[model samples]
Target: MFVNFRRIRKCQCVQLITTCLVLSLMMVCWEQLDNSVVSHVKSYSYRYLVNRYTFINKSFTIPREEAQSFSNFLYLLDHPNKCKGQDVLLLLFVKTSPENTERRKAIRSTWGNETYIRNTLGVTVKVVFVLGAPMTKPEQLLWNKRAGLGLQGELLREDLLNGDLIQQDFVDSFHNLTLKLIMQFHWAHIRCPHADFIMTADDDIFVHMPNLVHYLQDMARKGVMDFWIGHVHRGAPPIRSKDSKYYVPFEMYQWSSYPDYTAGAGYVVSRDVADKIYQATLTLNASIYIDDVFMGICANAMGVSPQEHVYFSGEGKAPYHLCIYDQMMTSHGHIEDIYHLWKVATHPQVKQRTSGLAGRLYCTAVKLALLCQPYHFNTYPCKAAFL
Candidate 1:
C-alpha cells in the first residue's frame, strides 16, 4: 500500500509541473500575438492615410566616411576635452519676433539656461535658436523664401512688418510658425547632422532637460525608437471656414479620426523619427492649425504615436511647480505669464503662492543679433538651407 501511494504522489507532481510549463508557453505566445496585432493595425492605418499624398524624395544617407566624420564631429561637440562623459542635449528654440527672441534669451538665462540645468542635473545641454518666419503669411512658398533669410533681414529688406506678416485674428498663428520651424530644424539635421535626440520647443514654454533625458533613457531601454514623446491630444476638432486662418477644408484631410499626437509646445523625436516626419511633410500639404495639431495630429496619420507621461500640460494654466513635480518635459506659458513661469521655476516660494496682487517689473529686453554671424555659413544644397 505504501509503495502504491508513493507512485501516485510522484505522478501527480510530474503532471502539475507539465501543466505549469504549458501555461507559461501559452502566456508568452499570447503576449506576442497582442503586440503583433497592435503593430499590424498601426501599419495598415498609416498606409491608408498617407499613401495618396505626394511623396517627398529626400535621402538621409550620408556616405559611410562622411557619417564617421560627422559622428566624430558630434563626439567632439559633446565631449570637448574628453573629460566630460556627459551626453549633449540639443534644445532647438523656434522664435518668431525680436520680442520672442528676447523672451527666449531671458527664459534660457533665468530658468531654461543650459548652465543652470546642467549644474542641477549633471548633464551637458546646448541651446540652438532657429528663428522662425512671421506668422501672418499663409502662402507656403513665400513664407519659405522669406524665412530663408534672417527674420530681421526679411523685415527690413522685404518690407515685412509685423502687421503685414502676422494676422492677429488667429490666436494660434504663432504656434503654426513653431511647426514650420521644427520642420526647418529637422531639415537642418539632415544638412548638418548632430545630436542623439532633437528637442523642439517654443520660446514661451518651460522645459526641464534632466527629466527629459531620464524619460528618454527609459524609453531607449524599452527598445523604442522612431517615435515622438509628448502630451497627446486625440480627436481634437478640426478648424472650419475659408475666412478663418485655422480653416481646414474637408478635401485637405478627409479622415474623421486622428491618431494620438503630441502637444507642439515641446516634444522630443528620435533621429529616425525626425527623418521620417521631415520626409512625410514634404509629401503632405501644410496644414493651417497650430503646431501640435498640424504635426502631431496630421503626421501621426503616418504612424507616429504621442508618448504620454506625467509632464505634458495641455491646459496651459497650471503652475510650473505642478508640472515639475509631475516630472513633465514641457509646459506652456503665454507672453503675459512669462514672469510667473520664471518665478516659479527659480523661486522657493513657488510651491506656496499660486496667485498674487503685487505688480513686478517684467521687462522684455530686445537685442539685434546679426544673421549668419560667426556661425558656419550653410551654402550647401540642403532643404533647411532653402528655409
Candidate 2:
C-alpha cells in the first residue's frame, strides 16, 4: 500500500527528459514534415472533398485579347514549312535553352534524327528545338542594347544549318516557361495542325523514337482521341516556401491541390487534345509560371486528364539495362551519355535478349530488381516491372 516515492520521482525525471528529447527531435524535423506529409494531407482533402476545378477555370479565364499578350512574341527564327507536304505522324517540340547547342546536336544525332525516323522507323517525325531569346546577365544588360544579338546570329546560323530551330523573342528564363508552353500549342495550331500527335520534351531527355513511333502507330490505328500520356503528377500541392525555386505564393495559386499533370520532362498529346489545349490557352490566365502546372490547369479546364505511361520517365534517369531500353518511351536527365545510351538502348541485341519465354523471364527479373526498389528511383514505378 506504500508508494515508492523515490522511484516515482525518478520516473518523473525520465519522463521530462524523454519529453524534451521528443520536442527537440520534432523541432528539427518539423519543416520537412510540414513540407511533405502535412501538405499532401491538405492537398488530398481539397482534391476529393472539393471535387470541383471549374472554379479555377472561372477564376483564371481572361479575355482572349488579354491572353494573347503572353503568346504574341515575335518569332526570330522559325520553320513554318517544316511539317508541310508531309504526312506527319508526330511533331516533336524539344524545349531547349539558347545555350544548349550541344544537347540539340546530340539529340539530332540520336533519337530526334528525322532521317533515321523516316528511313529506319518509316515514320515522319519533325523535330523542332523551341527557345526564347537568350537571357544576358543583369549587369551586362545596360551596356548591350541588343543583349542577345550575338546569340541571335549564332542561332540564325544554327537554324539555317539544321533548319529546326523555333526561336521566339521573349527572354528565355525559367519564369517564362509558360510562355514557351503557349508558344508550342499556338505554333502547332497554326503550322502543324495536321500532325497526328504532338510531343513536347526537354532538351536533355532521350526519346526512344522507334518505340514511340510504334506506339503512336498502334494508337493511331485504334483511332485514339483525347490521348495525353506521360508520367502523371496527381493531387500535388504547391510548395509554399519562398526560398524554393518552385515556390507558389497563396495569391498566385490559392488552391490546396493542383489538377493532375504530366511531368514537363516529356509528354504526348493527340492532335485533338493539342487543339483543345490551344483553345484553352486562348482564354486561360497564363500567369501561372510553372509550365507543367499550367498545362494541368489547361487540361483540367478542357476536362482532359493525364494518363500515366510506364515507359515514360519522370525527372530521374531510367536504369541502364536492356530490359529498360526495350520499352522505354522517354528517359529524362540524360546530358552527357545520350549517344552512348542511344547506341546501347537501340541495339538489335536488346530485342533479341528481351524476346521469347526465356528473355521475358530474364527481363521480368531484371525489371523487378531495377524498378521494384525499396525507395523510388523516380524512373519507372514499381508496377512497371510487370508491364
Candidate 3:
C-alpha cells in the first residue's frame, strides 16, 4: 500500500512540474507577442499622425512652369455647376511596362471601337497612362508604332520615378500621386462640367462599360450617390513585413477587420463621394497602402461606406473564362491573356454566346486573337440614340 501511495505521489509531482513549465512557456510567448505589437504600434504612430497636407505644401512644390500650366488647365476645366445628373465618366489609370505593350494596345482598341456604346449609354471614358520613369519616350514611341489599333488618350507622366514612389522616406509622394489624380478629375469635371459618376480603374482591368452604366443608372434611380462601390473582403490583416511595399505598422490601423474597403482594381464613387474624398484629404494623413486600400480607409474615416460588389476582382483572376462571356473587369492577366480577354470582351459573336459555349470558346479563341491593336486618343462620339 505504501509503495502504491509513493508512486501516486511521484506521478502528481511530475504533472505539477509539466504544468508549471507549460505556464512559464506561455507567459514568455505572450510577452513576445505583446512586445511585437507594441513595437509595431510605436513605429507607425508618429508617421500616422503627421499632417500630409502640410508636408506636401512645405516639403514639395510643383515647378513654376508646370504649376502655371496646371493652374491654367484647371482654370479652363473647373465648372462645378456643369456636372449634370446623367453623365458618367470613366477614368483608367495604367502603369505602362514594356511587356504590357500588346495588352495596352488591346485595351486601347477596345475603347476605340466601343464609341457607339458610349454614345448610346451617355458615358465618356478616358484612359490616362501614368507611366513609370523607366518607361522612356522611345519605349512609348515604339509601343505606339503599330497602326490600325485604338490606343488613344492622355499620357500623364508621374513626377516621381518608380524608386522614388516606393522609397520609405517619400510617404508624401504616394499621397501626392493620388491627390494629383483627384485634381485631374476635378479639372475634368470643370472642363466637361457635366459628369455625374466617375470610375477609376487600373490598366490591367477590363470594364464592361455597358453593364457598369446600367448598374450606375439603376443606382441613380434609387437616389444613391454618396457611397463608394467595389469588391470588399472581410478581416484582411494589415501588412507588416519590412520587405513588403505595402507594410502597415499596427498603430495606424490596428483593427483586423477593414470595414468594407474596396478592391481598388475597379471602383466607382459618385461625384459627391469624390468631393468628399477630396475634402477628407485636407484633414486625413495618408496611410501607406496601395492607392485602393488607402482610398477605402480614407473613405471610411469620412463616413463613406464601401458597398461590396462581386464584379471587381482584386486577385489576378477573371470572373469567367474569356471566350464564353463578356468580362466586365478582370484584374490581372498575362500579356497574352490580357490581349485575348480584351478581344473576346469586345467581340460581338463572343458576346452572343448564351451558355456553355462561352467557356469552350475562350480556350480556342485565345490563340486566334493574338494581334496587337494600335493606340490613339480621340473623342469618339457615341452613335447610340441616347447620346
Q: Write the per-residue lDDT of candidate 2 for residues 1-387, one digit (tens) a residue.
A: 999999999999999999999999998899688678989999999898986788888999999899999999899888889988999999999999987889999999999999998999888999999999988777667625544677778888888899999988998889999999999999999999999999999999999998999999999999999999999998999999888899999999998999999999999999999999999999999988999999999999998999999999999999999999999999999989999999999999999989999998999999999998888666899888888
Summarize candidate 3's per-residue lDDT along 1-387 as a digit string, tens digits: 437888899999999999999999999999768766765564345335432323322322334454343223212111233234534454444444323455566666664233655666666554444332222244356655431123221211121211101111111233234444444444444543345566665556666656666777777778777767766644344666666666667666554434346765667777778777655544444434356665655576567777765445554444344332343433444345655655566566655563365544553454233211122111111110011
- What is the overall TM-score of model 2 with all chains considered together? 0.93
> Which order, best to worst by lDDT?
2, 3, 1
lDDT of 1: 0.48
Per-candidate count of clashing residue pairs (backbone under 3 Å): 3, 0, 18
Candidates in order have lDDT scores of 0.48, 0.92, 0.49
Report the poorest 10 consecutive residues by lDDT, candidate 1: 359-368
Candidate 1 residue-wise lDDT, 294-340, digit = tens: 56534554566676543554536333333132233566665666666
Quote the positional error of residue 209 for candidate 3 in Å. 2.5
Clashes in model 2: which pairs? none
- Which residue pairs in candidate 1 have backbone atoms (N, alpha carbon, C) closer than 3 angstroms, thus clashing? 136-165, 148-387, 311-328
**C-alpha root-mean-square deviation, each candidate:** 21.0, 3.7, 13.6
Best by TM-score: 2
Q: How many backbone clashes does candidate 2 have?
A: 0
Distance from true position, residue 15, model 2, in Å?
14
